[model samples]
Target: MTDIEKKEQYAPYISISRDEWKTLNGALNFSLSDEDISKLNALNEPLNLAEIQEVYFPLSHLLNIHIDFAKKLYEAENGYLNSGRKRSPFIIGIAGSVAAGKSTTARVLQKVLSLWPEKPRVALVTTDGFLYPNKVLEQRSIMNRKGFPESYDTKRLINFLADVKAGKEHLEVPIYSHLEYDIIPNRVQEIHNPDVVIVEGINVLQVNLSEKHQGPQVFVSDFFDYSIYVHANEKNLLEWYISRFKQLQRTAFQNPSSYFHRYATLSEQEAIAIAANIWDLINKPNLIKNILPTRFRANLILEKGSHHFVKGVKLRKV
Candidate 1:
């Protein structure tokens, strides 16, 4: 290939500094209020509001467009038939490697999107809830590979989305507890037909990847009206994972009931080593073998730099 082609190929992962970020988002009209900025700043670490404006404002705008499109599609399909029935929830899928900040992205998106005038009552559901119960994982001898695609109750997840998409009222979902690392028995979170539902996890876009795999017919992503993947290089992601793990160890691990409490007593060096090992052995391999390959399938991509700030975005070509 020519140099130009090679450059173009490598350009998808390009970085944008905080200065350029402002320029990128300058055309977007959305801005966080002083209260919103204060809440975001009150996070464990400081963040630049200008950087957020550059990154997430455009994202929120795109989501607004996606919501509009979904509404139009719903109307066209039902309005023509003269039906006055309510439509189902608009589903969005968010997929990324562990410690890539997809969870944070989902939460931030939920907060921002819920503020919109047209689409209110947004709900966020995680595929983490669809994970097989810890008992089941232990019984199957696959406890170590908890985030793999096969570890999820894919059928139940699909059915849940299908029910929500069909405008089913009062749909219940099993709640998973991170502290206990198990599904709470006889408990469910009720979904009351919201305007948007975002399903996020490490393998949200992953299917069997082939017909011969004989896994299952319906994948969780098939129900999504839009999908997003947070992108970053493996090296940056490994560093980010280590940092998050250390923070979690200092905080969440202090809880008596946390599944990761055993790691709380480790020295700083020891903790870093353990976190690096987990990333190398589990997360990095999974990203290379499964998650990263699916980046091309996303409807849009949020590419971030080392500081966990989004630098650029790539939308799939029409």
Candidate 2:
């Protein structure tokens, strides 16, 4: 069955074709140049001004409407409680398989949302920073399962989200280096007060149950005011993963400091083989076992075609 047909089985979501979705782009006066799109595009992913107009433009507008409603809800609750309370940042969680273009979606949203007439302060954070250090993974003997849920510092990530929702200021987030393939030693990213926060990762919408828990459990999605999932078929995802791996081998892997520097010397066929193996052994299993199960949990879903272009959008009915 097709992706849209599969989605039709779920009554909670209203799926719309790309052509239909583009018509919802109301008079909100905004435009992004090709230069801007080039900066926002992820490695090997294609994003153009037309895609932005058809997809992201309406998405951003919808988010702004949600944000406005959220502000009003805060005010109403404060009044009902008869207490002076400050509004907290609206957290947005973006989750999907690796190489599904989620990073590009987050970056584009951050840029587009920041450009709104209100000019709200927008902050972007990836859960990669919350990943357990390579040393920790090695010690646990799960180094090969780097992207698995257990490899993440879930407690720390939950705490960070809690603090951000509590209006904490000058929060420090650990930095993860993709080139080094590990968390940085001491460097950190500081997040100040922002109107919106975009948390992007492979496992943002994931839920883990613990037998040791007594009361209620606090999940990462609990802190998100809105959530999005980027979706593509397994075949397309594998192809994109291998393509990105080959591009990295030509670029980042060539750096002497890169953790995968050995891959830089590999021939084209050898690199393709390695990439396919990694995807099969690591990424594909993770997607089926953990990530794909959480797709329906998202408030919005961006379905992509084989070319890395969004072909349809599914929004959860209120």
Candidate 3:
């Protein structure tokens, strides 16, 4: 075990090794094929069937347990109160650093959970859509801090979550285009009362103190029925971030409409330098200042190794 894992092996959580956690799968049949995994993987990240069976199958099983219990609890409460209250969607929040494979995790979980026998309707949403448009960021003079908490329209995000938790139907969420590096105006993704909602973002777990005094502070995580933090060492995170940037330079960045089109012509060394600079200046600072601090607040933590594979799992004790 790493020193960090040793330190975290205390109350409120039970730290389990990867081998041990895989046993918790309890003979659950995994139906996802290799092609499905390839499609679900994020750029430059490798996710295979073994990883899904060993890591995510157990995770999906655990989430199923939680979902079942939550439903029972809601039903019991309604019976006692004699109020016909509809059960709200189970919201799962996933928070991690840039290029930490959070998107893949969310997508895989969404797929696995939706495949259950009951076939729950799973909806996936990223907090990127909650980010203020590029124009707003430039106007606010914080375009450099694009992934930071201040870059998000926190009030709107909170309201959206509130509505989702209230069992509101046919809600429209703003769509963010990574290629264009901005919110697409007049475009929205409609979410209609999903059974499970997976919210992924770098700052989903973040809580800003400045917003507290404004009123009853409702953080983005307030509505999450469960939360996950994808953890990795800074070395691995930096390497993965640069690798993804390089891959995007060859692919998405080459497009004329891409916000990073200028980077498409950069040499190998030039791309590395630029990626490192952006990581150091923007992503790293935000990770340390905002994202990393909220790691322990998560109900579950998936610790990753240098190769982006989950090495261990820390689940919060109920």
- What TM-score would each prediction reach against the true structure? 0.87, 0.96, 0.96
Q: 79-149, model 3: which lDDT tens digit per residue?
A: 99999978899999999999899999999999889889899999999999999999999999999999999
Off by over 4 Å in 1: 1-48, 210-216
Q: How many collisions between residues are there in candidate 2?
A: 0
Candidate 2 ranges beyond 4 A from true positions: 1-10
Error of 1 at 144 (Å): 0.3
lDDT of each: 0.79, 0.93, 0.93
For model 2, where is the 10-residue window of minimal lDDT? Answer: 25-34
lDDT per residue (tens digit) for residues 20-99 in model 2: 99888776658677788899988999988888889988999899889999999999999999978678999999999999
